[model samples]
Structures are given as C-alpha cells and as structure tokens.
Target: MRVMELVRFGGADTAFATRELPQPVPGPGQVLVRVMATSVNPLDLQTRRGDYRDQVALPAVIGNDVSGVVVETGRGADDFQPGDEVWYLAPVFAGLGTYAEFHVVDQALVARKPARLSHVEAAGLALVGVTVWEALVERAGVRAGERVLVHGGAGGVGSAAIQIARALGAEVVTTARARDHGFVTGLGAGTAIDFSAGDYAPQVRAMGGVDVVLDTVGGDTLTRSPEILADRGRVVSIVDISEPQNLLAAWGVNATYHFVFVSPGRAKLEALGRLVDRGELRPVIGAVLPLADIAQAHTLLEGGSPTEGRGRPRGKIAIAVHPLDQPPHGTGSSGREE
Candidate 1:
C-alpha cells in the first residue's frame, strides 16, 4: 500500500511524504477497501497545519473522504463482499485514514456508492454531504416552503447544503462571490448574495429574513446572524467559534444555534445516496489530482500557488488514488484495478 503520510505538522510543502506500507487486514466487523479516490477537506488542511496536533500523531495518514471498491471483508462483516463499490467518511483521527491505496473501516461506516455518481464524485461528496445532512436534516429539520440561508455557497459544504435544502422543498439563499452567482444558482440556490459587496444582512432582511441560517464562514457571521433570521429561526455552524460573540441579539429574535463538528456514519451516507439517486443532489468537483500530487491538492485548497490552470477551486479537490481514469461525473466505476 502507498500512502501520503503527514510526517510533520507544518506547511503543505513540507508536511507530507510519500511512503510504502503493508496493506492492512480488516478486523471483525470491518472491511478492507481498495481506495479509488479521496477528497481534500478543510479538516485535512487543519490536520496538515497542526491545528489538531493533540489528536493526530506524527507520521499519520490523515484524510476523511473515500470512495472505493471492497477487496476483502473481515469475519462477520457480511454487509458487503468483495467487488462492491462503496463510499464513506473515515472517523476523524481514526487509526488509519483514506490517504493510502487501501484502507480498513468498520462496515457500519460504509455505504453503497450512489449509482449516479462516479468514484471521484462520491469521494468529493462523502464528508461534505454528511456534514450538511447533519446540519440541515437532523439538526435544523429544514422543512418545505421555508427559506434557508447558506453561507459560503461555493464551498464544498455550502454547495451540498444548497442542493439538500432545495431537495427538502425549501427555498435556498446562499452567500458567495460575484463570480459564483451562476454556479450557486445552478445548484438550486434561489438567491446568491456577494458578502463582500456590502452588508448582506440588510439585503437578506429586505426579503424577509430566512427561517434557517447555516454558518460555514465564522468570524462575525454568528453574532450578526440574528439580524437576518426570522422569528425562532435556527442557526447551524460547522466552523469552530474561536472568540466570544454577543448572543443577546439572538435572544430577542428567539434564535436557536447548533454548532456541528460532523461525526460520520453510514446512515447519513445512505440518506445522501437517496437524494443523489433521485438526482436532487450532485457533487461539484473543482479539480482532480493524482495521489502523488497530494501536496499540490492541499495547496490549492488552502488558496496557495499553482492552481494547475484553474483560477480557484470552486468545489472539492479530489485525489485519484487508483487512477480509474473516470470523469468527474461519470455514471460509475469502469472496473477494478487488480
């Protein structure tokens, strides 16, 4: 098995090293998968930069999203057999991550890959899809005919939220750059506001504040959310609150706040698969790089140099671990590689 291991906690350029290791054998209730693709998330960037040094040890394989084919199953792991296509978000800081060509995960954490999505797309959506599902469906309980405001609509989580909210019959409004208006709208956001142009609160207020606000961009967004929230509106935040905010405003509006650090599982992946199979949810891939270019993928996600001709990543950056030569939105995997 080949892996891009995090040798140190530092910049993307120096933190990672490619190495060869023995393939892991699945334990009871676990399955070994031949990783087809994996996607980079903000969590990966944080892990690479030492933000979670306490949780991750040096020389660790750190990645969450994985879409692959089952190669072997452990004793009692009857949920899937060899050659079954699957996708999952590896438990954060688990023993080994999906950065390697082969990964072992509890069978309970894996789900059948959505038939409509290829390995690249499934890998890109796994983590973000689970995060958004936790925020919108399980936590906020977003309902039909309601207006939902999603911050950072062009981002991985934000993009998935837009599609999920729309699938729930809620009207979607997202915050994004001027250039991404079309992109967000194409994903079913009814309105796209450029947060940089001016105070977006006033614009959102103008159209009668939203019933739910998803805070992907932290900073003052949490504190200022009351200004754009409807009565009893729910606010869900995935970003960690680094500073204290005045929540007195939320009291007046009867606002509810839920902070989510996603815990991945197969149930959430199955829920997302239902939507994907229905054509209501789709993965938006900004770029795809080979496993050897894992460092470059991190750089692109961190807004660093060498975009590889793309101006900026619009969606998730996926690593082709098995080189399926599959298109971004290809219907399914072509075949297994050895």
Candidate 2:
C-alpha cells in the first residue's frame, strides 16, 4: 500500500514522506475500504507541525476525511457489503488516517456516500459537513427562525454552516472578504459582511442581533461575538483560541458557549448524506490533487506563499487517491508524477 505520511513534525515540506507499507486488515465491526479520495483539513497542517504531538506518533498517516469503496468487511460488519461506496470522517488521533490507498475503519463510522455526489465531492464534505452539523444542530440545537451569524463564510466549515443554518430555517449572515460576498450569498447567507472592512459587530447588531454565532474563524471574532449576540444567545466555536478575551459581556446576557471538537459518527454523516442527496447541501471543493502532492495541498490551504500562486483554498482540498475516469475539481495534483 502507498501511504503519504508525516515522517516527523517538521512542517509540510520537511515532514511528508511517501513509502510502501503493509495493508491493514479489518477487525470485528470494521470494513476495509479501497480509498478513492480524501480531503485536507486545517488540522492536517497542524498535525504535521506537531501541534498534537502527543496524539500523533512520528511517521503517522494523518488525514481525517475520506470517500471510498468497500472492498471487504469484518465479522459483524454486515451494514455495508463489498463494492458499496461510502464516505466518513476518520476518528481524530486514531493513529490510522485516510492518507493512503486503503483504510480499515469501524463500520459504525461509515455511511453510504450521497448518490448524487462523486467520490471527490463526498470526500470534500465529510469532515467539514460533520463539524458544522454537530456544532449547529447537535450541540447548539439551532432552531428555525433564529438569526445566525457564521464567521469565515467562505471557509470549508463556514460554507457548510451557512447552508445548514439556512436549512434549519434560520436567517443567516456571514463574514467574508469583498470578493466572496456573492459567493457566500449564493451559499444561503442573507447578508455577507466584509470582515476586512471594519468591525462586523455593528452591522450584525443592526439586524437585531443574532441568536446563534458560529465561529469558524478564530482570534478576535470570539472576543467580539458578544457585541452581536442577542440576550441569552449561544456561541459555538470550532477554532481554538489561545489569547485572552473578555467574556464578561457574556455574563451580562447569561450567554452560553460551546467549543466543538468534532466526533465522527455514522448518524451525522447519514444526515449530511440525506441533505446532499436532497440537493439542500453541496460540497465546496477548492482544489483536487493527487495523493502524492500532499505538501502543495497544505500550502494552498495556508495561503502561505504568494509567489507559488497559493491563496486560501475556496473549500476543502480534495486528494484523489485513485484515478478517476472524470477529473476532479480544482486541478490539485492531477496529471503529476507521484
């Protein structure tokens, strides 16, 4: 099996190594998938940089999202048969990741891939969709008619959060740059505020304040959320903040805060699958690269180098682990040597 791994946490360029390794066998209640495609999450870069060094060992295969076809099933794993197309978010810190040609995952974490989507599309949506669904629906229980503000609306999680919020019957507002106003609006945001322009709190407050604020972009956004939150409002943050922020304002309104670290489950993926199949949700793919070119995927996601023509990717960076008859989106790593 060909696996792209983090040889050590020395950052993207110095960290990645491609090597042939033995294929894993499925255990009870597990299924062996011949991975078709996987997507890059911001966490991938973090893991490669040793942010979670305690969880990920050296030479780790550290991807969390995948869309693949079942090749075999373990004892008691009767839910999916051979040849079933599936998509899932691999368990975080689980050691085995989705960065290889084959993955042995617990069957309970897998769901039938949305029929209308290609493997690349499903791969792009798995982790980000689950994160948004968990944050807005499961954790916060976002209700219909609520006004919700999504930070970083053009990002992978924020884009999905906007549509999920809209589908839940909430009016949605999002923060993006001037270039993404139309893009975010097209994804179901009622209003797209340019965060780069100035403080977005006043603009959101002008619309009577939000009942829910979903923060995909961290930093001062968390600190300023209280400015736009209605009394007793709920705030869900997916990004971790290390700096100090005054939450004293939250005390005034009895504000409740929820920090989300996504948990992988079949039910969440199944719900997203239904939404995708129904055309109420769509995956946003920024780029698609071959499995070997993993470093470039990280660069594009970080938007680290202007000279490399790398800017923040539009959505998730999809990696094609296996060749497809039809090319995937964004020309990530296709047509290149491994």
Candidate 3:
C-alpha cells in the first residue's frame, strides 16, 4: 500500500513523504478499507506542523476523513463485510490514517456510506460533520427556531455546521467574506454577514441575537462571539479557547466554551449517514486533487481562503486516493454518497 506520511513535523512540503508499506490486515473488531478518497482539514495541517505532537504520537499518517470500500473484516467485526461501502474518521494518533491507499479502523467507527453522495463528498463530510454534530447537537444543545451564528461559514466545518443547523430547524446565520456570501447562502444560511466589511456582533443583535455561535475561526472572532449571545446562549469553537474566563466575564453571558476534537464513534457516523441519505445534508467539496498532489492540497488549506491573486476555493479540499474509475459503490454526482 502507498501512503503519504509525516516523517517529521515542519513545513507541509518538507514533512510529507510518499512511502510504500505492506498492506495491513484487519485485527479483531476492525475493518480494512481500500481508501477511495480523503479530505484535508486544518487538523491535518496542524498535525503535520507538530502543533499537537505532544498529544498525538509522532510519525503519523495524518488524514482524518476517509470514504472507502471494505476490503476485509477482522474477527468479531460482524457489522460490516467485504465490499461494503463505508466512511469514517480515522483515529488521529493511535491508528493508521486514510492518506494511504488502504486504512484499518475499528468497525464500530465505520458507517455505511450515504447512498446519495460520492466518495469524495463522503470523505469530506466525516470530520467536519462529526465536529459540527458534537458542537451544536451535543455541546451547545441547539434547538429548532433558535438562532445560530456560525463563524467562518465558507470553510469546511462552517459549511457543514450551517447545513446541520438548518436541518435541525435552527435559523442559521454565518460570516464569510463578501465573495462567499452566495456560497454560504446556498448552503441554507438564512443570513450571511460579511465579516470583513461589517460588525457581526451588532448585526447578530439586530436579528434577535443568537442562541448558539459556532466559531471555526478563533482569535478575535471567538473572543467576540459571547458578546452576541442571547443571555445563556453558548459559544463553541473548534480552534482557540485560550480566554474562557476573560471572555465570560467581559460578556456577562452564561457561556459554554468548547474545543472540539472529532473523536471516532460509530453511532454518530451512522446518524450522519442517515441525515445524508435523507437529503437533509450534503458535503460541499471545494476542490479535489489527486493523492499524489496532497502537498498542494495542504498548501491550499494552509493559505486559508485564497487572496485576490490566488484562485480561491469554496469548500472542503479532497484528495482522491484511488483512481476515479474505481470509486466506491453508492457514489453520487456531488462527489458524495448521500
């Protein structure tokens, strides 16, 4: 099997290397997947740069999301079988990842691919879907009719969060640059504010404030979200959470600040699959690159939304691990299985 791995922690191009390794067999309670597609996330970039090295073991195969076909099943793994199409979050530090042609993961963490989406979309959704699910549904306890503001609406997690919040009946508001307003609106955000051109806090207040704020961009954005919360409303971030006490005190709001790490879990993955199958949610794939061009993908992600001279991307960036013709079963037109 061929895998792209981070042999060292540093620059994207310098750390990632392609290596040939023996195909792995599934262990008990595990499934071996022939990876069809994988997507890049900020977490992948952070891992490559050693930002989480103290928490994640070194020499890691770093990708987090994968859409693939079950090639083999280990003993006690009765929930899945060979030839079943599946998608999952590969365990970050403790397990091998989806950056390779094949990956082995716990059967409990694998879910049947949504029958409506393609491999690329399925792969793109796993990590972001799980993160958003955990933050809004679990941590923030967002309810229908409640107002939710999602920061970084055009990014991977932001895009997924908007769709999930809308499906759950929440009035979704998101912040993106002016150019991405249409893209975020198309994903069902009721209000798309230009973060660069306007003040989100005041804009949110004019619309009855917000019950939940999902912050994908940290720094000042995360710091200011609490100010717009409607009393006991919550603020959850997948990135920086360094000033919880100060932010809470300054805002005078009952806030629940959270740092999201999308853990691999079977139940959540299955729930996400059901949502996709029902057409209530979809993964927005901004770009797709061949596996060999993963370095370029990382470069793009690291650069954030492209600047004026650089071509900008609209959604998640995916890397095709297998040939396009060999895409996993149940794939759909949107590059997702759902």
Candidate 4:
C-alpha cells in the first residue's frame, strides 16, 4: 500500500514523503478501512514539525480525520460489517493515522457516514466537528439562550462551532477579518466582529458580556477573553492559556481552560452524523488535492505560499486517497470507494 509518512520532523517538504508499505490488517475489535479521503489539520503540521516530539513517537503517520469504507472487520466487531461506510477521528497520541491507502481503527471509534454528505465532506468533519462539539457542548456547557463568542470564526473548527452553536439556539458572535465577516454571518453568527478593525473585548462587553468564550486563536485572544466574560462565565480555549492565574485573578473569573485533544468516540461521531444526515450541519471543504500533492496540502496548512488567490486556505483541505470506482480489498459491492 502507498502511504505518506515522516521519517523525521522538520519542514513540510522535507518531512512528508510517499512510501510503499504492507497493507494493514484489522486486529481484534478493529476494522481496516480503505481510505477514500482524509483532511489536514493544524495538529498534523505541529506534530510533523517536532512540536510534540517529547510526547509523540518518531516516524509517525500523522493524520486524524478520515472518511472511508470498511474493507475488513476483526473479531468482536459485529456491529460494523465489511461494507459499512464510515468516518472517524483517529487517536493522535497513539499515532495511528489516516494519511495512507488503508488505516486500522478501533471499531468502537467508527460511525456510519452521514447519508447526506459525500466522502470528501464527511472526511473534513471528523476532527474539527468533534473538536467544536466537545468544546462548546461538553466543556463550556453552552446553553440555548447564552451569548457565546467564537474566536477565529473563519477557520475549520471556528466555522463548525458557529453552525453548531446557532443550531443549539445560542446567540453566536464570532471574530474574523473584514473579508470573512459576511461568510461568518451567513453561517448564522448573530454578530461578526472584524478583529482587524480593533479590539473585540469592548464589542463583546457592550452586548452584555458573553456567557461563554470559545477561543480557537490563543495567545493574546485567550489572554483577553476572560476580560469580556460575564460574571461566572466559562471560557474554553483550544490553544495554550499561558496566563491562567493572572487572567483569573484580574477579572474575578473562574476560568476553565480547555486544551482540546480530540478523542475518537463513536457516539460523538454518530451525533455529528445525525446532524449532517438531518441537514442541521454541513462540512466546509476549502480545497481538494490528490494524494500525490500531499506536500502542497501541507504547505497551505502550515501558512506556506498562497493558493486559490488567498493568503491562506479558508477551511479543511482534503486529500483524496483512492479513486471513486474501486471497491476496496476484502469488501463486496457496498464497500466501493467514494
């Protein structure tokens, strides 16, 4: 099987390369998926650059999101048959990835793909959707009538968070640049603040301080979010919150800083699947590239040279792992690759 991998961590061009390896087989309670598509995330780049070397093992296959067909199912995996169409977020710390022709995932972490979406769209949702869902719904405990602020609203997780919050009846406000304000608003944000214009803290405060803050962009934004929180408001950040003590002390805030490490859970994937199948949510694909162009995909993800006339790609960039017509090995008709 053909796989993209990194022998060492460094530049995207230097670290990522294609190689041939033996196809993976399903182990007990696992399933071998013939990958149709996989999407890139910031974590992929970060891991590839040795940012998490102390934590993650070397020579890792570093993708987390996938939409694929089940080619084979192992013992104790009676729930999912060989032909089931599935999507999942791979466990990152364990280092089993989706950037290959086939990936073996625990059957407990897989869910049927949303009926309404293509494999491309489903692939794009696995990681970001789970991240947003966990942050807003699970950690922050966002309620229906609450005012929630989502920072970096145009990015993958931010975009998904906006739609999910709106669907749950939360009054959503997001920060984006001028060009993305309309896009964010169209996604159902109640208010879209242009971060480029000025500080977002005052604007959020004027709207009756937000009940929850979802900070996707950390650094200064994370530092400033606590200031705009309502009394006893919750703050969830996916990025590092460097000044947790200072921020909490100065603002009379009881902060719950979330360092989101998205886990693979079948129940969460099923929830997202139901939302997509019911037309309540949709995945945004910023660009599509062939498996051979994996390097270019990494470049766009790592803030490398521009593509599609934008300085950076807007949403998920997916890599098509297999052609649409082929039926993956070990499966019959229903396992046709998408």
Candidate 5:
C-alpha cells in the first residue's frame, strides 16, 4: 500500500513524504477499505504542523475523511461486506488515516456512502457533514422557521452548514466575502452578508436576529456572535481559539454555547446520507488533486480563495486516492476544524 506520511512538521513541501507500506488487515469489528477518495481539512493542517503533537505522533498518516469500498471484514464486522461502498472519518492522531491507498476503520464508525454521490463527493462531505450534524442537529437543535447564521459560508463546513440548516427547516443567513455571495446563496442562504464590507450585525438584527450562530471562523466572530443572536440563541463554534472571549452580552440573554469537535460515528453519517439521498443536501466539491499531488493539495487548501476575476471555490478540496479521472471540479480548508 502507498501512504503519505507527515514525516516533519513545518512547511507543506517538507511536511509529508510518500512511502510504500505493508497492507493492513482489519481487526475485530473493523473493515479494510480500498480508499477511492479522500479530502483535506484544517485538522490535517494542524496535525501536520505539530499543533496536535500530544495527539499525533511525528511521521504519521494524517488525513481524516475517506470514501472507499470495503475489501474485507474482520470478525464481527457483519454490517458490511466486500464491494460495499463506504465513507468514514479516519480517527486522527491514530496510525490509520485516509491519505493511504488502504484504510481500516471500525464498523461502528462506517456508513454506507450516499447513493446519489460520487466517491469524490462522499469523501468531501464526510468530516464536514459530521461536524455540521453535530453542531446544528445534535447540539443546537436548529428547527424549522428559525434563523441560523453560518460564518465562513464559502468554506467546507460553512457551505455544508448553510445547506444543512436549510434542510433542517431553518432560514439560513450566512457570512461570506463579496466574491462568494452568489455561491453561498445558491446553497440556500436567504441572506448573504459580506462581513468585510460593513456592519453585518445590524443587518442580521433587522431580520429578527438568529436562533443559532454556527461559527466556522473564530476570533472576533465568536466574540461578537451574541450581538446577532436572538435571546437564548445558541452559538456553536468548531474553531478553537485560545484568546478569551467575553460572554457578558450572552449572559444577559441567557444564550447557550457549544464547542464541537466532531467524532467518528455511523449514526450521524447515516442522517447526512438520508438527506443526500433525498436530494435535500449535496456535497460541494471545490477542488480535486491526485494522491501524488497531496503536497500541492495542502498548499491549495491553505491559500486564500482566488480573488479578482478568478473564481471562488464552492466546496471541499479532495484527493483521488485511486485514479483521478476528474480534476478539482470546484468541489472542495485549514488546521483547527473548519
């Protein structure tokens, strides 16, 4: 099996190396998958940079999302068989990652890939889908007729959050740059505010504030989120910032807060798959690269959205682990979680 290892922590160019490794067999309650596609996320960046040094050992495989076919199953892995299409979040900081040609994951964490999606699309959606599911549905419980504001609406999680919030029957309001207004709106954002252009808080307030604020960008966004939140509104942040944010405003309204770190599980993926199969949700693929070009994938994921007359990406950036017949079809993020 061919694997990309994060051998050193620093620049993307020097951080990873490809190596041939012995194929792994599934353990009890696990399945061995022939990885077809994988996608990059901020988690990959932080892991590569050694920010997660306590969790990830040096010279490790680091990718977190995978869409693949099951090759074989270990003992008690009766949920799937050879040839079954599957998608999962490969446990980060552990030895197994989705960057390799082959991966082994627990059956409990595996879900059938949505029949409506391609391998690349499934790979792109796995981690981010799970993250949004956790934040919006599991944590915040966003409901119909509620207004939800999604920050970073053009990025992987933000794009997915917009669609998922809409599917959950919430009216979606999203923050994106001027370049991505149409893109986020197409994903079902009724209102797209350019956070850089002016005061977005007033605009959101005029529309009855928000029942939920999903923060994909931290810093001041988290600090200021309570301003746009309806009384008792929930704020969920995936981004982990060390700087202390004052919640005095939130206290006045009795606002609830959640910090989500998405964990691998089959139940959440199945819920996402149900939406995908129903055509209520779709993966946004922003970019695609071959497995051999993973270093370039990292670079592209970190780079700012193309400016000027250049196009802004729609979804997640993916890497074809098998054969890449499709280029980065504008379906495709950085270190923390967004």
Candidate 6:
C-alpha cells in the first residue's frame, strides 16, 4: 500500500516522504478498509510542527478522518461486510493513521457513511463532525431557541458547528472575516461579526449575549469569552490551551467550561448521519487534492484563509487516497467552494 509518512518534524516541505508499505491485516473485531478519502485539520498542522512529538514516533502516518470501503473483516467483526461504505475518526496518536491506501480500525468506531454524501464529503466531515457533535450536542447541551456563538465560523469545525447549532433550533452568531460573512451566513449563522475589525465581544454582548460559546481559536478566547456569555452560559473549547487564563469573570455568572479532545465512536457518526439524511447537515469541502499532494495540502492549511491570498479554502481540504468521482449534485451547502 502507498503511504505518506512524516519522516521528520519540521516544515511541510521537509517533513513528509512517500513510501510503500505492506497492507495491514485487521485483528479480531476490526475491519480492513481501502481508504477512499481523508482530510486535514488543525491537529495535523500541530502534529507536523512537532507539537505532540512526545506522543508520536518519527516516520508516522498521521491523520484521523477517513471515508472508505471495507476490504476485509476480522474474526467476530459482524457489524460490516466486505464492500460496505464506512467513515470514522481514527484513534488519536494510536497506531498508523489514515494517510494510507489501507487502514484497519475496530468495528466499534466505524459507521455507515451517509448515503447522500460523497467519499470526499464523508471524509471531510468525520473528525470535525464528531468534534462538533461532542462539543455542542453532548458537552454544551445546546437547545432550541438558544443563541450560540461560534468562533472561526469559516473553518472546518466552526462551519460544522454553525449548521449543527441551527439544526438543533439554536440561533447562530459567528465570527469570520468580512469576505467570509456570506459564506458563514449561508451555513445558517444569523449574525456574522468580523473579529479583526475590533473587539467583537462588545458587539456580541449588545445582542443580549449567547447561551453557548464554541471556541475553535485558542489565544485569549477563554479570557474574553465570559464578556459575551449569558447567565449560566456554557463555553466549550476544542483548541488546546497553551497559556493560563483567568476565569474570575466566569464565577459571577456560573459559567460552565468544557475542553473537548474528541474520541471516536460509531454512535456519534450515526447521529451526524441522521442529520445528513434529514437534509439538515452537509459537508463543506473547500478543495480536493490527490494523495500525492499531501504536502501542498498541509502548506495550504498552515497558510491563512482564501481572502488572505494563502488560498486556504473556506471549509475542509480533502485528500483523495483513491480516485474519486464527483460528488452527487446538490449534496453540499451553499457555503462550500471548491
């Protein structure tokens, strides 16, 4: 099988090397999948930059999102059979990741891919979808009629968060670049504030604040979030905290905090699939590159957004491990651009 390996920890140009490896055999309760597509995330950038060097060995296959077809099943793996379409978030920092033509994961983590989504779409949604589900649905307990604020609304998780919050009957207010206002709004964000224009907290607070805040950008977000949080509001952060923050303001309003490091499970995917099938959720893909262009994908993600001329897409950047056909027409949100 062909694989892209992180040979060293450094810039995208110097870190990756392509190599051929023997296909892995699934263990008991596992399934061997022929990978069709995968996608990059902020975690991929951190991993490439050696942020998690202590957890990963050199020459590692590092990626989590996967959408593929079952090629083989191990003993006792009765949930799926050969040729079943599936998607999953591979265990973080476990064994080899999904950056290869073949991957093996336990059946418990795999879910049937939403029939309405293409392989590229399913691959793009896997990690971000599951993360947003955990943060908004499970952790924050977002409900109908509530106002939810999402930071980095044009990015992968933020984009998903916006739609999911709306689907749950919450009104969405999101932060994005002025140029991306249309994009985020198309994803169901009722209000879009440009964070760079000035301090957005005051602007958001003027709208009576929000019941929930989903933070995808780390720096100073924790310290400033309370300023715009409604009484008893929940703040769920998926970004890693690199610095200490004062939560004194949170004490006054009984603010609840949740820091999510997502773990994979079939149930979460099924929940997302239900939303997708109901036409409430759709994957937003910004670009689709072949597997050999993994290095370029990393570079594009590390760069800024499309408006900044870095050419970063508004949504997920999918990598095709195998040749993929065009997505079914009208399977994407209006916010999506290729």
For candidate 5, write residues 76-162 as lDDT tens digits. Answer: 999999979899987756677888888898999999988788889999999999999999999999999999999899999999999
- Give candidate 2 misplaced runs (Cα > 4 Å): 325-338
Q: lDDT of each model, Cα atoms only?
A: 0.91, 0.87, 0.83, 0.82, 0.86, 0.91
Worst 10 residues of 6 by lDDT: 328-337
Query: Model 3: per-residue lDDT, tens digit, 115-147?
Result: 788888899999999999999998998898999
Higher-lDDT candidate of 2 and 6: 6
Candidate 4 C-alpha lDDT tens digits along 174-272: 999989988888888989999889888898888887888887887676667678877778878787445643464435676666657677798988888
For residues 189-274, could you state the per-residue lDDT of candidate 2 as single tens digits?
Answer: 99999989998888888889999999887887777778888888999999877898888888887788999999999999999988
CA RMSD, predictions in order: 3.4, 3.9, 3.8, 2.4, 5.6, 5.1
What's the C-alpha lDDT at position 278 in model 1? 91
- In order, how many clashes per candidate? 0, 4, 10, 0, 12, 0
Clashing pairs in 4: none
TM-score of 5: 0.93
TM-score of 6: 0.94
Q: With candidate 3 superimposed using the best TM-score fit, by how many Å does residue 153's alpha carbon deviate from the native? A: 0.6
lDDT by residue for model 6 over 1-338, one digit each (tens)? Answer: 88999999989888888988889999999999988899999999999999999999998999999998888999999999997989999999999998898899999999999889988999999999999999999999999999999999999999999999999999999999999999999999999999889989888989999999999998998888889998999999999998999999998888999999999999999999999999999999999888888988998887744555776788999998876454312223121212
Off by over 4 Å in 6: 304-310, 325-338
* Model 1, runs deviating above 4 Å: 304-310, 325-338
The candidate with the higher lDDT, 1 or 5, is: 1
- The TM-scores of all predictions, comma-separated, are 0.95, 0.95, 0.91, 0.93, 0.93, 0.94
Q: Output the better candidate (5/6) by TM-score.
A: 6
10 residues in a row with least lDDT, candidate 5? 329-338
